[model samples]
Target: MTIYQKVQAVNHLFNQLDKDLGSFQQSTGLGCVANCGLCCLKPDINATALEFLPLAYHLLLNGETEQWLEQLQNNTEDKLCPVLNKVIAPGSKGFCSDYAHRGLICRLFGFSAMLHKNNTPTLVTCKPIKEQKPEAVAKANAHIASKDNYPLISNYYMQLRSIDESLGEELFPIRIAIEKAIYAVLAYYAYRELPSKDDIV
Candidate 1:
């Protein structure tokens, strides 16, 4: 399949996962703190190139791919995500500039699960949620144990790899992942005619 096709497929999975996470949040009343960007401030976040394909493709369509590629390449310090904005203070008020096309880690961090040694799923969440809504966190964990519909980190990652073995398998720092994703799209269209926005749909 073409790069564009793979991006769309991966995005479809993300959309489904988003819906599931929203439902889980509504049911259990557990969610990110209002206007909190603490998790976004973490510089160690990792992701795969395939996870950022949609973001790179969006930038390409908007004629911003080269600009972002340059910014990411120069950001060798590997600070916070390039897409993040208003980060005047670490773990303070900020948000992703391109919310719609954020990577898989961005989507799953606050509302997903991690597998334990005994093969049990544990709800992985942030400190604010754990401290402010301890009861909700416990309830959400119980709900996960009783239900099978919540999005799983391992499962979605497996789905990502199924889309493209090479791009999906290699984990990179989030910045490097974004850079690789942009280059992948650019290389795919280096010789071929660029697909129109309508063609993407």
Candidate 2:
């Protein structure tokens, strides 16, 4: 699929998520706290190449693609997200450097829901919410039980897979995922600029 088409897909999914989260908040009166970056600080969150495509596009548009790739390569062993700002003003949350094109895992980590084995839905949320808002938790759980929530990762991924199986199907470590996504975007433009050649796949 073309890069533009990929971007369109992410936008559509994000809109759907916005609607779903709005409804959920109206019903449950719950949300992730402002300035909480615990999940973002986690060392092991993973993502797919497709999830980072938008970030890649943004990097290219701003002419920072190669620079960011070099940054990632130089920091391969560091678990911190490229977008995270470790040093910030006191009481300020470290922010995503590329919030607009953040990966699916980035988007999904704090606010989304997942399906449970007993045919129920569960909020896949971060720790702060669990501690700070016990009552909201009860209400949100009720909302989840109603089952009219946003499309889960599995569903969105299925749709993405239909567009390009490789993107939808391949999973990688968080660093690797980011690397692949960057390379995917770069290679895409490079390929677009090249003459068409037959590959004996």
Error of 2 at 2 (Å): 1.4
Encode model 2's per-residue lDDT on 97-157: one tens digit a residue.
6566677777666456777797566777767898898788877777667765653656666
Alpha carbon lDDT at 21, candidate 2: 66
C-alpha positional error of residue 34 in candidate 1 after TM-score superposition, expressed in Å: 0.5
Cα displacement (Å) at residue 83, model 2: 1.2
lDDT value, candidate 1, whole model: 0.87
Q: 46 in model 2: Cα distance from truth in Å?
A: 0.7
Highest TM-score: give the candidate number.
1
Worst 10 residues of 2 by lDDT: 192-201
Candidate 2: count of backbone clashes, pairs at least 3 residues apart or interchain = 1
Q: Write the per-residue lDDT of candidate 1 for residues 1-201, one digit (tens) a residue.
A: 998889889999999898989988988888888778888888888999999999888888878998997787786876778988855457644488878889999999978888898889999999999998898898889988986677789999999999999999999888989999999999999999987877543
How many clashing pairs per prediction, in order?
A: 0, 1
| RMSD (Å) of each candidate, 1 decimal | 2.8, 5.5
TM-score of candidate 2 versus the correct structure, residues matched by position: 0.85
